[model samples]
Target: MKKPFAIVFLLILSSCQYFEKQVPDEEALLQKRLKEINWKEVSSYPSIAECDAILDKELKKQCFFESMARLVQEKLDLDTIAMLYPEMDTINVQVTVYPDASLKFEPQMPPDNTVSYNTIAIDSILKARLVDFPKIEPAQKEGVPVTTQFILPVILDVE
Candidate 1:
């Protein structure tokens, strides 16, 4: 009876390893989850007060873009960009929204080198005219604020 009981206890202790779960490595798991995330897209887009009421995600994004483009167009219309580059009807502006809600605008040069414009002058003009815009809420990814950048085509309709 004693021998049988001792054997049974040893067997139970040895089999306990099967029930013990191997703890997963947290760093490895985090890396896997990070890989699964789509880094290109943001959870929420940067927006102005006018776009806050929009509930649909896509529509909200569209509203923000359109509003920005309109504001930029209106501002640049007051500048001499149209006179300086009469051949250019539209300019692509690269807008960057930082996590701190600050904005930066850069003039995107034409892909074809044949179309040449003074980039430094254009940049200065943009900086001067595009200031004092309505406050913008920064974009977010996974509920954390992030920097986002996109290009907007602004029509030169100063006439």
Candidate 2:
């Protein structure tokens, strides 16, 4: 009776190890699949009020870009700047739209390009743009609001 009981206990312990081995592999595969997905690209881009009515995905994207361009052009005062460099024809503005619908814009110089402008003037211009900033609906990934980066190219055609 003692020998039979010992054999059954050993069999039960061995089966548990086999079940444990299967779990790790399944867990590891799940982790790998999650990492493979790109979280940056969302199902839909962030929208302004002007883009809210657009149902088509591609058209909505275009409307978002156009609305952003119009907003910047309408607010930034180009006439206030006195260009110190004749070669600089463009300014690249990088704006990070937060999940809470606030924008943080900064002027960044490209690696191969040069920018010559007063910081005070640029700050004032950006401040004016923010005054007219639209109420933003942030980008969503899997139905959760996400922060997004937008780059705008402003042509400096100062006469």
Candidate 3:
């Protein structure tokens, strides 16, 4: 009988993991994934004005790099992305990348369950751009990988 109860607890614990929305070590995972990407080629990105303001020119140079430093440091910004888009199903947010830029977007405007089950189709969009940082290819660096991160301001109003 004790074995049955123990088994139930194990099953419950396993199932509970599915409900967890945040990714553990997201920056580490981002870094790991970045290694796989050949960002030498050009990709489209949004204008920089749309991203968060860290206005001092010198600081802007390291904003994305600094942001990811949180992965190494103890700092974190939680529940911030979800606040921007409430209905987004954020299991794995798709990040769109371009030369010198990257955009983070989630599923926008799900279906109006009451009005129709048509499955309203909405898509992810741009995050931001790099005006100061020139698009440097991996080849140009002669070895160093070049990548940039941006947090897109997705306009989500429940109107």
Candidate 4:
């Protein structure tokens, strides 16, 4: 009876081979997955109410960008800025929009053309105009909200 019991126990122990060490390291696995993600690319563009009715993907993106441009032009007194800095033909503004619709305008880098103004003045103008900016439905990757960057070209009429 003892010999029989020993044989059965041995059989049970040998049959229960569940821990084969297939997963080497949980952290490593997570790192590999993270590496595979393209951080620069998003699955969807940030949206606004005006763009919600558009059905086509490419068209929708175009509409969103157009709406942003229109909003900025309407709010910002570009003519006044141009008068202050007559030499600058173009102003390239870099903007980053957050998930909560907050915006961060990067410090203006003086363009190649010759025009100088107080950084504070530029910052104030941008902040004030942006106050009227519509609520943005933020960009997403894997269904998670992400910050999106935009380079807006403000062409000044140098007169």
Candidate 5:
């Protein structure tokens, strides 16, 4: 009886190691992928309302977009990215086309009430652009490049 019990205990312990999953090293993967990122074509886009929200919020805080506009990088979906990283100042986005491709107006924040889907944000930190990263490397599936979208945080100097 003792021998049988010992064998069973050993078997259970040995099998537990097999249940553990080895997660892929994402940091190394991102570094390699960002190197492959084509940087010549980034752009910025914002609907009047979208920019306004950021401006209104900032201005209300006594930090105007005009004074902080230089720090804007690109716009991103706050709701979407915020879910992944609760403390992230910005989201991780990749894209091939520039959001500024068709934006001909001044790079200032939008006024009180215009809305646009292509628009993201500009804050005291960086400005973000909205674009579709045509191909997300190492596709989620084994054979297809998943169209993963994100906010590519841009760093700028407001001071």
Candidate 6:
């Protein structure tokens, strides 16, 4: 009976490794979390002071976009683009907001190369007219500011 008891105790001690839990690798866990996050979407959209008070995410974004479009339309309305290209009704402006709260505006050229619009003049006009805008807060992702780019279609109602 004594020998059987001693053998049982030794077996239990030797099998202790089976009950021990393995710690997961931190680097591997971090990589898995990063993969799960959607990099394309931002946690917060860029906003102006007017849209800052809004708590709803979608509404805030809509307000910002509408404000931008309205400003662009007002600015371009004063330009000679309509007189130059009477047939052109809308221009797609690519607005890039950098992490440092800086902005860049570029005119997106039409896919058809045969179009007679002067892209250089349009780009210059966009840069010149789209100035003196209200201070813009940069977009954020995971609590860090991130660069975002989007195309805004500005209608030219010069009539």
Write the residue-wise lDDT of candidate 4 on 45-121 in tens digits.
88999999998878888998888767766556544666776665566678788988787765465754554567788
Which should have the higher lDDT, number 2 or number 4? Answer: 4
Q: Write candidate 3's Cα lDDT for 83-131 as tens digits.
A: 4445542222233334444333433333355432112223221222211
Off by over 4 Å in 2: 1-36, 82-87, 110-115, 157-159
**Tens digit of per-residue lDDT, candidate 1, span 33-86:** 999989989999999999999999999999999999999999999989999988
Ten contiguous residues minimizing lDDT sum, candidate 2: 77-86
Best by TM-score: 6
Q: Write one digit per residue (lDDT tens) for candidate 5, span 15-109.
A: 99988978769998999887876554222222232244553433432332232222223233332433332334432223222233221122233
| TM-score of predicted structure 3 | 0.21
Q: For candidate 2, lDDT tens digit of each residue in 41-129?
A: 88778899888999998899889988886677555535443254456566677878888988888866656635445666676667765
Lowest-scoring 10 consecutive residues by lDDT in candidate 3?
Answer: 123-132
Better of 2 and 5 by lDDT: 2
Q: Best lDDT goes to which candidate?
A: 1
Give candidate 4's error at residue 137 in angstroms. 0.6
Local error of candidate 1 at residue 108 (angstroms):
1.2
Task: Please give the distance, in angstroms, between residue 11's alpha carbon in candidate 6 and its true position after superposition.
Answer: 19
Query: Which runs in model 5 stand beyond 4 Å of their true positions?
Result: 19-23, 32-159
Best-first order by TM-score: 6, 1, 4, 2, 3, 5
- Model 3 error, position 152 (Å): 3.1
In Å, residue 127's CA in model 4 sits off its true spot by 1.5
TM agreement with the true structure for every prediction: 0.82, 0.67, 0.21, 0.70, 0.20, 0.83
Give the higher-lDDT candidate: 3 or 4.
4
Q: After superposition, how far is residue 54 of candidate 4 from its true place, in Å?
A: 2.3
